[model samples]
Target: MNAAKPTASLFQRPAWVALFAFTAAFAWGWAYPLIKLGFAEFGIGRDMTGSKMLFAGIRFCLSGLIILTIARLTGRSFSLKEDGRKSVVGSCLFLLLFALLNTTLHYAAFYIGLSYSLGSRASILNSLSVFALVLLACAFYKSDKLIFRKVLGCVTGFLGIMALNLGGEESGAFTLMGDGLIIANALCGAFAGLMTRGVNKRVDVFVGTGYSLSVGGALLVIPGLMMGGTLHNVTPWGIVILALLIGISTIGFTLYNKLLTCNPMGKVAIWNSLIPVVGAVTSCMCLGETFYSKYALAAVLAATGIYIINKGKK
Candidate 1:
């Protein structure tokens, strides 16, 4: 008889999970500078709201189509079945709303706030999404544990964010409105992440992403049209931005979903604390921004926190 294939030991699984999470976070980090670049090229603030909306809409629609095609080609079943269709539909709706809030408010806040704050500061503040999710998970879903390791992880991550913030140069006006908008963006992202956990149980992650991006992108069209952004003036750079967005949505979410199959959501989220550090580093490299000592400190803290959180957790 042929020898049985060796199954992966428990020790092997966490390593693989951590690897996947790190890769996902890296790709997501790269996307931040790309977004800023796109905004600069497209004259984000100068562009009519309608134009921005239309630009976002087209990108997401294309992203959805691409994912759908990939799903079909891979022979992954796309049907929700009658019983789960309603849940899928509801999840899609929430996703659309989440997308709208994230794309509109988050970008708006970041751009506006960037003008007032230093890049380091903005990057740190952006990392607040992790904390927001932790709170939301505790209050609404009862999904996260407030254990010592988790608390330490949160604190360590927050410190890393602060280090990044303190390290960069200030640019724009620091208005209360800008601060509030950024906070709102963090809240929306937290809610979206939490919602994805619930939704993924019912539908494929790609399907959920496709539906959400498509519907959300479509919804932006009406507002875009109202805001005077027609289809005529979109530049090549705009197209590039849209493409990146789609890529992030498909690759980032798909990997995240895959990781979830083998790990707890909270554990996975802890890795996300690395995003700000990655973002700051990438931004410095690509945009010629200064790299500060605080960034190094933040990275160390984030790394230590991840170790504490994931160590020995099966």
Candidate 2:
């Protein structure tokens, strides 16, 4: 990433960069519809309970291997050692903890939550990570202070979250399957982000991410299989789609991270608003659901909050 920093600056060409950023962001957004389509194709449903986890496990595991392969082909280091001279034990330990926090627990809850929730709702609610991380960082890191704008931003974001849940008993009420699971998923993801910050100083960033995803995802498959999840309904076309989803994860994450490493964090961070926006819109289209004005309002509030947080001075 450091060596490629110069080239990435070329990507910072305002118009072209915006296009690249949106395209990358759209790939992540694509996951919303693709995951649902996977569920439908495999005959998985909310009632299946374990199938979603199983499906996510496969996607992450495959994506992880793909990433690792790319890293190796590009001659990137996977060493856990900060300076490439650490013991095998230390490296193994780093991979273990990273996999646990970043992939295993995080996606288990996320996929399950997404299973029971509307894609549009899931996209909006999952944006809670920004606010949640603000609070988490304040508690854990000396440098991350909460000021007036941040607090106000967090409030605005939370209000947007509340707005999404106001329709009625069917859509509004929190269930273990809906709001409950997504909130848990967001917390886990925030922690994972923090964990990444910590471990990046100790190991190769790409290596840690790749290995953790592979290990954690493989572990998820165990519980899913024990819980009776199966991919018996998958077809050749479904396999092709699943492959596409994995490609999204692999390419989307790498590019997003690379851009962040190469440019101003604020510049890259603002593009994230596109993730939920694209996810909600595409999910609505895929589900054949009508667009509601509330979704727009929610997206704006949440996006504004994220902007404020990232734009804060150090």
Candidate 3:
């Protein structure tokens, strides 16, 4: 008989779960504006696709190394024998595939898509990943079945996302490189959530996350460099922004992945609706961008959706 899968005792606590989830959301929300700032500070233009990829690759790769180093110090084994199903090479290959889908392809689409899309539209479309996770979890996880409350909560949260775009100057214009890719990035996030849960069951959550980010990030750097990507005219502020982004990935992904292992997917995912709301409000505050009255409404809607999802829990 197989032994039970181990879980992080601390993450199972309600307070810690709430804290980490909110922190992750806030960090991700802040990343929108920060990324824009990084580009400006480093003199990377909208058309510098390779540079964008390289920037993201460096951030994630460093974050992964940080996680791995911490995990090693904490005595987590880097071995794949725990699964007993795949050979060492096979396990590496498995993780490589996960890294590809979860990090490389996902963020590649995201950085490129952001170049072609408006920030407001990107915020709304990217938050759609929350809904995707809720639905996908139902399909894959036996515990996360579909229900009226789940549907209602999702609709409400999604309305919050849509609310942010109301009265905005964004046109209905769409492109495969812009809108389509952002939507695809959202879907990648949804799928990655599911994959995180599975990986956690077999390996240490931090280890899996570390591998995914580092390996996937390296893949981006190779092609990015080949395409002549460069972080030119980088200033001190740019370096600081890059470091903060690395910290964001390290903290946000580590805690979020840990939360996934211990909580219901729908309940955990519902909070993601707040990301765009936070992104919109933060963009205004940090980027000297326009603030819309609809932002307040969006926050309330997102909060309400999270309450409903958690309140109706069995």
Candidate 4:
């Protein structure tokens, strides 16, 4: 008889999981600078909320379609039959709600906030999502209780966030349109992270993510168009930038979803600390933004917090 096959993919291995998580974080880090560059290339201005929405919509919508197409080719079913006695319509409604929370509101807030904030500062602030995820996971998952270490970690991390206001263009007070909206984005993202665990139990991660992106993106596009949104200074380079953004969404979300499905939420998410560091450094380097001393302090604190959280309970 032939030997039994291992059946597990490399991604299932702990080391591989860590590697993929880092890679996903690194790719997302680049997105901050690239997005700013994209804005400039397409002639998108800070006040052009409509155009911003439309641009983000196209990137996510195309990402969804590409992911779905790949899933189909790999023979993954798109059925929600496993989601229990809920009708197909009910399942779809749930998905739409998820899409709204996951993609539409999430990116809508992000794009708007980024327009008003510096890429470096915005990236660091976005770490709010990571901290939110830890707490949310504690609330939702019995396995992810808030240990002393976790609490300290969160406190330390929040200090890093508070430090953001001490330097740079910010005047140490939150702006309603800028910082508030980004915090809103972080809340949406935290909820989405929790929701993905439940989603993966019913449907393939790729399928759920695709529908969320596509439908939510379409929702953004409609409002954007109604608001007279239009892309300006479209060029080959702009198209390339858009394509890169799409790839970032596709690859980053897919890997993240898979990791969340397979690992403890806190374990998987603690690595997100790397995001602000990568994002801040890359944004300064790529966008020529000033790297303030406070930014480095924030990154260090954030990294230290993550280390404590990941150290695990004795």
Candidate 5:
């Protein structure tokens, strides 16, 4: 009888998973500028909360449907057999909070902030989510250890953020509300990350994602309808954006879940620092935005921070 070949171990699976996660982060980073463009096309701004909600709702709904179809065609099971009730309940709560805070605030605030701030500054500021996650991890879950190396990494990353900010034109009307919204958006993302850890303990990742997206998308539609975001103004470009959102969400979230399963939360969190660099580069290249020394400096700092953080782990 022929000897059976050994299957890849869990640790071995992470190399490919981490690579995909990084790619997904890069794609998502580009999505910032794309979303900004879409909002501009629609003449929507931060003050247009209703319109923003509507736009986000439509994008998520379209993406969710596409993901559902793809999941089915791929022969991936959709049934929430394990913790079906808990998953549904948890997903519903997550959806409500996420749509209300994370989705709405993130898009609206980001667009508004980008108008006031430079692309590099906005991108680097966005990396503060890592800081938020770190604090949350330390306080709530104790899932990660807070050592000198991690602290150094975070400090370096913050310096990158500072570099990016220093290169940008300052917004004169920096309101408490706007800053609050951005901070809240980061907190929501961190909370969502934490919540996913809990949910994944019981259900499969795809099923959980499907549930969250469906419920969250549906909730977003209600506010969207109230805001007059009809099917009338959606252009071909809008449709393309919607399609990309779904594709990325499906692939990115799935891969992220796999990575989380295989690696420490802190390690995965550090990868987030790469997002700003990717976003800034993509925006400059695709949208003809200008690049500056500050952006390069920020990238270097963030890269160094990520390396330091991850190196200490191994």
Candidate 6:
């Protein structure tokens, strides 16, 4: 009578998990275009880091609030209880730290990076998290050791990723916001990924997610407003796009992190390597950018690399 075991077993099915992963990844991929579009719709200038962070703050804060509400109203354990009453205090403390690292730093870097770079280029560069995670995991966890197969997979994936930038256009955008900040975003994600493991062990995920996002959003919003940030000319379409952004953050994070809970990190993250490819393709179509023949080839390489990495898993 292992009730939880069956749920775990169901999630363990590779096909089911992969399907879920793809759906969430697809939702996330749309963010590149939506954000670029949102910037236009909301009158957010390219150099307006304050406005950019304000928008991000709103997106994450609302998403977190909605997610936490859903989980709580549905009778899920949305607060820290397993570790007793005293643990709630500690849980709140952990959430503050997590919010600072995960949402505040990660999105501050991401928004600033996006402001300076094209969505397509940012998409490609932001996914360096996969490679960063491989290194960090190998260094921190004995269980996630590196082998020839893993190395080969990483190389193949990275090569394909780099190939996306082979076109002169992609290469030309390399700058602080283009590559450096995106890499920083990736590193922040990797750092948060490690912290998530500890958070899951000690706190209710819904509560942590809610607290961190709310706190982080407030933090960003304060500074942004002080810096003369204001969202202007919001039309109906702007509301729709902002709502979509919130949906993506809430649903995408829930599904992706749930997958990481039920499956191995490599299994979850390898599939995520496709985010950049998906983002690039989506951006070209929606952002009025031209697509090149080499982009298709790069997508194939990235997909193949994901398969190779997953296949190498024991």
- Candidate 4 has which clashing residue pairs, if any? none
Query: Taking the tens digit of each residue's C-alpha lDDT, what string does model 5 give over 148-244?
Result: 8778877887786666545335422223454444545556667666666655555555555565565666667786788665544567887676667
Query: Model 4 — TM-score against the truth?
Result: 0.94
- What's the TM-score of each model vs. the native? 0.76, 0.85, 0.89, 0.94, 0.81, 0.89
* Alpha-carbon deviation at 116 in model 5, angstroms: 4.9
- What global local distance difference test value does model 6 have? 0.76
Candidate 3 deviant stretches above 4 angstroms:
1-8, 84-90, 160-176, 294-304
Error of 5 at 9 (Å): 6.0
Q: Mind giving the per-residue lDDT tens digits that candidate 4 earns over 30-134? A: 888998899999999989999999999999999999999999999998877466235666666777878998999999999998877877888888898888999
lDDT assessment of candidate 4: 0.86
Q: Is candidate 1 or candidate 4 better by lDDT?
A: 4
What is every candidate's alpha-carbon RMSD to the true fold?
A: 4.4, 4.0, 3.6, 2.4, 3.8, 2.8
Q: What is the lDDT of candidate 1?
A: 0.63
The sequence of per-residue lDDT tens digits that candidate 1 reaches over residues 61-114 is 676667778877888766664545767667556555655654444444544455
lDDT scores of the candidates, listed in order: 0.63, 0.75, 0.80, 0.86, 0.64, 0.76
Residue 33 displacement in candidate 4 (angstroms): 1.0
Which one wins on TM-score? 4
lDDT of 2 by residue, 1-314 (tens): 45655443565566766676777778977787788888889888777767877898899898889889988999987755554245567657766876887678878887888887888888888878757766776677676666877788888888888778676665545678777888987787666655665455666677666887788889888888989998869798789879999888787656654554345444554566677788899988988755677778889898878767666443
Which residue pairs collide, candidate 6?
Answer: none
Model 5 lDDT on a 0 to 1 scale: 0.64
Deviating ranges (above 4 Å) for candidate 1? 1-12, 46-50, 81-120, 138-143, 162-179, 230-238, 297-303
Any idea how many clashes model 1 has?
8
Per-residue alpha-carbon lDDT of model 3 for 279-313, expressed as tens digits? 77777778776655665676678677667766746
Instruction: Point out where model 2 deviates above 4 Å.
Output: 1-24, 83-91, 170-172, 257-270, 310-314
Residue 11 Cα positional deviation in candidate 6, in Å, after optimal superposition? 3.2
